[model samples]
Target: MLKFEKVSLTFKTEGREQHVLKDLSYTFETGRITAITGVSGIGKTTILNLAAGLLETSEGSVINTFAKTAYVFQEPRLLPWKTALENVTCVCGDEKKAKFYLDILLPEGSDKYPDELSGGMQQRVSIARAMAYDAELVLLDEALKGLDMQTKDAVVKTLREHLKGRTAIMITHDKSELEFCDTVLEISDAPISELKHVNR
Candidate 1:
C-alpha cells in the first residue's frame, strides 16, 4: 500500500513559487487498479513522480511499502537504438515473456527499432516493457495516449491479464481505460473525489 501523509509540494520557477498540493493526504489501496483522472496541469504527473520518489515534497511524507515498481511515462522513453524486444528484455531479462507481450501488443514488429515504428506502436512497446518488468507496483501516466480505440482495448486487455493480484496506478483521460480499474480518483481544484468504485 502507498500512503501520502499531509503531503505538500511546491515548485519554484522564474523566482516565483507555485503551490501544487497543500497538505494533501491519500492512500492507495492494495491489490487494486487505481486510475487518477484530471484535466491538464492539475499536477497529475507530479503525484506520479512523487510516488515514484523521483520528486521531492516540500513537506510531509510518502509511505510506499511495495518492493518493486515500474513507471511508464507519457512518452515511450525507449532507447532509440534498441529494438522492441531488446527494450522489454533490458529491464527484466525475461526474453520469453518479453516476446509474449510484444506479440500481443505489436505482433508484426518486435524486431523494429523505436524510430522504425509509429508513435502508437512505440507506446505499446513501452507498455510491454513495463509489464515485462514484473514489478509489484506499476505506475503509468498517460501511457496509452496515442493508440486507437481498438489498439487501446487490446492493450488494456493485455495489461488486465498481467495486473491480477498486483497494484496498478494509472493517470489517463480516456474513459474506456477506467473499466479496468477497481477505483477511479478524480483530481481537480477540489479534493480528490471517487468517480466509480468497484468491489473486487
Candidate 2:
C-alpha cells in the first residue's frame, strides 16, 4: 500500500520558490493499477518520484509498504553499451525470465544495443526490464509514449497480464492508455491541491 498524507513538494529555482504539490493527500491501493493524467509540467512525474522515494517532500509524508519496486522512466534509460536482453537481465539476473519478457516486448531485437533499436523499441525494452524484475510495485512514467498502435496494444496486454495482483502507478498523456487501469486520477490546478477521480 502507498499513502500520501498532506504531502507537499517545493523547489527553488532562480532564488524563487515553486510549489508543485501543496497539501495533497491520496492513497494508492495495493493490488490495483492507477493511472495519473495531466498536462505536461504539472508535476505528474514528480508524484511518481515522491512515491518511489526518489524525491523528498517539504512537508507531510509518503508511506510505501511494498518491499520491491521497479520504475520505468519516460526515457528508456537502458545501458547504451548493453543489448536489450542484457539490460533486462542485469536487473533480475535471470536470463530465462528476462527473455520471457523480452520475447513479449521485444521479440525481434533482444540482442540489439540501445543505439541499434528505435525509440519505441527501446521504450519496450525498458518496460520489459521492469516486468522482468517482478517487482511488487511498478512505477511507469509515460512508458508507452512513442509506440505504434499495434506495438502499443501488445505491450499494454503484456502489462495487464503481468501487473495482475500487483500495485502499479502509471503517468500518461494519452487517454487510450487508461483502459488498463482500475482507477484514473486527473491532476490539475497549479501546485496540485487535489486529484479528481475520473470514472471509467
Candidate 3:
C-alpha cells in the first residue's frame, strides 16, 4: 500500500510562504483504484505530485512502498524527436509491447511522430507509454482534461483494462469519467478526505 502521513507543502510564491497542502493523510489499498477529485484551486495536482514524489512536502512524510511507478499528465509530454514506438519502448522492453499498445490505442498511422499525430492520438500514445512502463503503481493527473467525449471514453476504457490489478491514483474533476475507480477522494482547504469507497 501507499500512504501519506501528515504531509504538507508550503512554497514561497511571490515572497511569503504559502501553504498548498495541509497535513494530508491518505491510504491507497493494494490492487485498487482511487480517484482524487476537487475544484480548480483546491490543490488536487499538488496532492498527486506529492504522492508521486515529484515534490517534497514541507512537513510530515509521504510514503511509497511500491517499487516501480509511472505517471501520466494532462498533456502527452512526448518527445517531439522520438517516434511513437520509441517513446513507449524507452521503458524496459523491445518493440513488441509498444506496438501492442499502439494497436490498442492509436489510429492506423500514428506511429510516425508527435508532429504527425493529432492531440487525441498524442494523448493515447502517452497512455500507451504509461502502460508499457510495466509499473505496479500508476499516477494520472487530469490526463483526460482536454479530450473530447469519444476520445475520453475510448482512452478511459483502454486504461481501465490496463490497470486491472494494479494500484492507481487518478487526479481528475470529472466524476462521470471515473468509473475506473472503486474509491474516490476529494481535497479541500482543510485536508485530504475520502469521499467514497467500495467494499473490497
Candidate 4:
C-alpha cells in the first residue's frame, strides 16, 4: 500500500532550480516487486529516494506505511572502515539471518575490507547489509550495474530468495530484470490519461 499523490520534486543549487520529478501519482500493491524502467536522468532514482523518504517532495505526498526501510544504491555503499561481517552486523538484524545470507551472497574469503574484495563482492556485501536491515520496503537503484552476468544472476537469485513476499521497488533499464517483478511500470513524459473510479 505505497503511494505517491501528485508528488513533484525540485532541487535548488546556487539559485538554479532543477526539476527532477514532475507531478505524478501512483500506487503499488503490498508484498510484490514493482519495476520502474525509463531512460537515464528521467527521475528513476528520485522516485526510489522519495519512497525511502531520503528527499522531501516539493509538492504532494510520498506515502509509505513502514517506518524502517532498506536502501541498496547504485554503488556498494559499504563503510570503508568496517569489515564485511561488521558492516552487516551494524544493523543488528537477526545475527543468524545476517550471517546466513551473507554466506549465501558472498563467497569464501570475502570476509575482508571493501578494498580487499572485488567489485562484485562489494556489491554482495551491500546487498547483505540491506537484507540485514530487515526493512519492510527495499529500494534498489541499479545496485547491480557493474557485475558480470553470472555474478549478477547469482546475486539477483539470492536477493529474490530473501525477498520472498516482501515489498521491493527497483529501477533498472534492463528488460530482463522485469522477470523478477510482478508489475512493470514505465515512466515517461507521456501522461496517464485514464482515471479509475472506486466506490466508497
Give the root-mean-square deviation of each candidate in angstroms: 2.5, 0.9, 2.5, 4.2
lDDT (Cα, tens digit) per residue for candidate 4, span 1-200: 68888887878989998777667778877899878776687678888888888889989898999767898999898888988887888775466766876888886744698999888888888888898888888888987777789888988898887678888988888777778887777766533211222221
Give candidate 1's whole-model lDDT: 0.86
Model 2 / residue 188 / CA error / Å: 1.3
Best by lDDT: 2
Off by over 4 Å in 4: 190-200
Q: How close is candidate 4 to the true structure, as a TM-score?
A: 0.89
The better candidate by TM-score, 1 or 2, is 2
Answer with 1 or 4, whichever has the higher TM-score: 1
Q: Summing lDDT over every window of 10 consecutive residues in candidate 4, give the lowest-scoring window.
A: 191-200
lDDT of 2: 0.94
Q: Is candidate 1 or candidate 3 better by lDDT?
A: 1
Residue 123 of model 4: what lDDT?
Answer: 85
Task: Give the per-residue Cα lDDT of candidate 4 at 183.
Answer: 73
What is residue 173's positional error in candidate 4, in angstroms? 1.4
Would you give me the overall lDDT of model 4?
Answer: 0.79
User: Any residue pairs clashing in model 2, and if so which?
Assistant: none
Model 3 clashing residue pairs (backbone): none
- My TM-score estimates for the predictions, one after another, are 0.92, 0.97, 0.90, 0.89
Sort order, TM-score high to low: 2, 1, 3, 4
Candidate No. with top TM-score: 2
